[model samples]
Target: MRTVAYYKGCLASLSAKELDISTQALAPKVGLELIELEAVTCCGAGDIHEAEPDYYLHLNARILAYAEETGADTLMTVCNVCTLNLRQANHALQGDPALLERVNRNLTKVGVPAYSGGVEVMHFLWLVAAGEGYELLKGAAHRGLKGLKIAPFYGCQILRPSKLLGFEDPDRPSSLERIIEACGGEAIDYPAKIKCCGFPIIQAREETALAELIQPIEQAKEAGADAMVTPCPLCHLSLDAWQSKLKAQTGKDFQLPILHLSQLVGVAAGLADSELKFKRHVVSVAPVTDKLAV
Candidate 1:
């Protein structure tokens, strides 16, 4: 088994720490070792990409530099946003030597060292499915989710309008649902599977964010999605954040649980309740947990 360094980005290491815990827990069953970074920093996620582009590239690139220092070629991450940002930085560095030089200069200013485009960055899901083959998926899966009407929702960054991490097709993505069914999950047809959850405007425009969120939830509900599964942490916050507010404003009634791909995969892994930290979620997974216990 090769040692795979996990670049548990700033958000996951700090606020969304469960994401780190969840994905690390997942790797062992898949015959992979998720080596933790000795020193990690923010990928300069969303805002940096637009505002401070040069510093952003160097910071994320330093992570790649760290991985290369270990002689490891693959860097895995759980955050879709971080993965995108870092991948964007790496891709830019490889193509434009001028931009790479500038970013390296900025990196030195931050004391993160130089980034030389030495490592490949990946999302943990993509990494697992590739490393383990579908068989480990078969082995880890124990839950009979055969009857579950799941909407395999891919948030904007993960699947995308195209470009970043071309591990799988962007427009007609099936990787998530493919793994879902392999683990005995039943896939549902939801219209808004590719729609953005309006995560970009959340801080600036809260009401718009909620309104944007309603679209996916409504579409999933309309298509009879028993639960919505996503790989993006920001997307989780959007869909699950203002549940009551959405209900009150739209007068739409339903209790839908937004699950991280790790959470859903954990269930398929047949993880014991003791192993899965189901309580860390701001959104309740009780309805699903109740069924699991019975």
Candidate 2:
């Protein structure tokens, strides 16, 4: 089995617990043995990076250090922001020797190992869309999605600032669509698939956030997507949880079911809905499940 250090960011550990559950459950089925970084703290969700850049590097470097301790060359994350933060840190530390030494000195004081910038930061979606993981996904899909129409949502953090997270073409990403097709689902093409879900600015601008959140769902609905799937828990929160608020503000009900990437893969792999934690979602996934049944 391919071994990697799994890092579930703050949102996945808390509000998006189902994302964590489904990811862990789906890993072994795809020939992956996840060594979860249990002691790792949050990647600061970009807030720390913007306000306190040095502390943000330390936090993410600490996470990388923990991953190094696991003896895994790869550190896999389910959240886009976490992936970005960790990658940004990795890039910074690897390129600047003096900065690495300084961070190492601070880490040493806390009894944590100094990170050598050896671990490669990767997103789970990238794992499944290419290489052996893609083959494993194809093999595990016993009961494929047959006729389900899934819109691929590549949230901002996972794709943008391509110099750092350059796994796929940020402008025209096809990883989600590739996975959907692999599982026998119809991949719907829509403009809002690559747009921001507005989670980052939700607290600062509720109205703007809701507007950003609704656009993709509305576009997906217009494009005939039965459901939407995303790799980022923050994006999932904006698309799924804040949907009600969007309805409240607009007086329009766009009941688009949002699935975590892992959950969608689990469904295609014939995993029981309960195992995927379908009940935990704010929006009912009944529409998607019902269609899958038919």
Candidate 3:
């Protein structure tokens, strides 16, 4: 069995437990041995870097250290922000001796081993969609999303700063689209395919944030997307959790059900709606579930 350390970031641990639930429940089916990192903490998600750069560096380094302790070759994250935070920290620490020393010093303060960049940080999407190969994912597909139109939401983390992230062509990402197609679904193409979900600036720029959230959703609805699928829990929340609020603000109903990539993959893998906790979503996933029932 191929082993990897699972890093369920802060949002998934609290706000979006369903992503964690579906990922754990679906990993085995996709031929991965997921080892959960219990000692792991928040990655700080780029926010702490602004004020306390050391905190961001140290927090992610500590998480990487824990993953190393698990003896796993890779640290797997389901959240885009977590992937960005951890990967950026890993890239920085490995290349900069001074930064690594500072971060390791902080980690040593808490009795954790200093990070030596031993483990690879990656998104779960890379493992299944790219690493394990689409054929493995397709072979695991007991049920097909034959008629489902899934709009792939990449968010920003995995795509931007393309040199460091290295997941896909930051200019145009087809990984998610390919995965959706491999699952037997139509991947809808839209203008906002690579746009930010505005979760990052909701506090500082609420109005602009709402507008950013509205763009892709409306585009997806216009493109005949049955649901929006994303890998980021924060993006999921920005799209699903804030739908009603956006509807009220814009006087337009965008009741599109936002799905975590795992949930969508689980559905394609023939898992039941109950198994993936569809009801946990604020937006009713009835459209997608009803299609699955057929």
lDDT of 3 by residue, 1-294 (tens): 579999999987998988988998888887889999988788888888777987787888899999988889899999999998889889998899998897788789889987888899989888888766466788887688977999999998888888778877887889999889888899999989789989999879988999899989999999999999998999999899888889889789888999999999999898765669888899999999898883
For residues 6-50, could you state the per-residue lDDT of candidate 2 as single tens digits?
999888889988998899999998878999888889899899999
Best by TM-score: 2
Q: Each candidate's root-mean-square deviation in Å?
A: 2.1, 1.0, 1.3
Total clashes, candidate 1?
0
Question: Weakest 10 consecutive residues, lDDT, candidate 2?
Answer: 285-294
**lDDT for each of the candidates?**
0.75, 0.91, 0.88
Span of 10 residues, lowest total lDDT, candidate 3: 129-138
Clashes of 2: 0
**TM-scores, one per candidate:** 0.91, 0.98, 0.96
What ranking emerges by TM-score with the best candidate at the front? Answer: 2, 3, 1
Clashing pairs in 3: none
Per-residue lDDT tens digits for candidate 1, residues 170-234, read 87888778877877777777767878888778779878887878888888888887788888877
lDDT of 1 at 60: 76
**Models ranked on lDDT:** 2, 3, 1
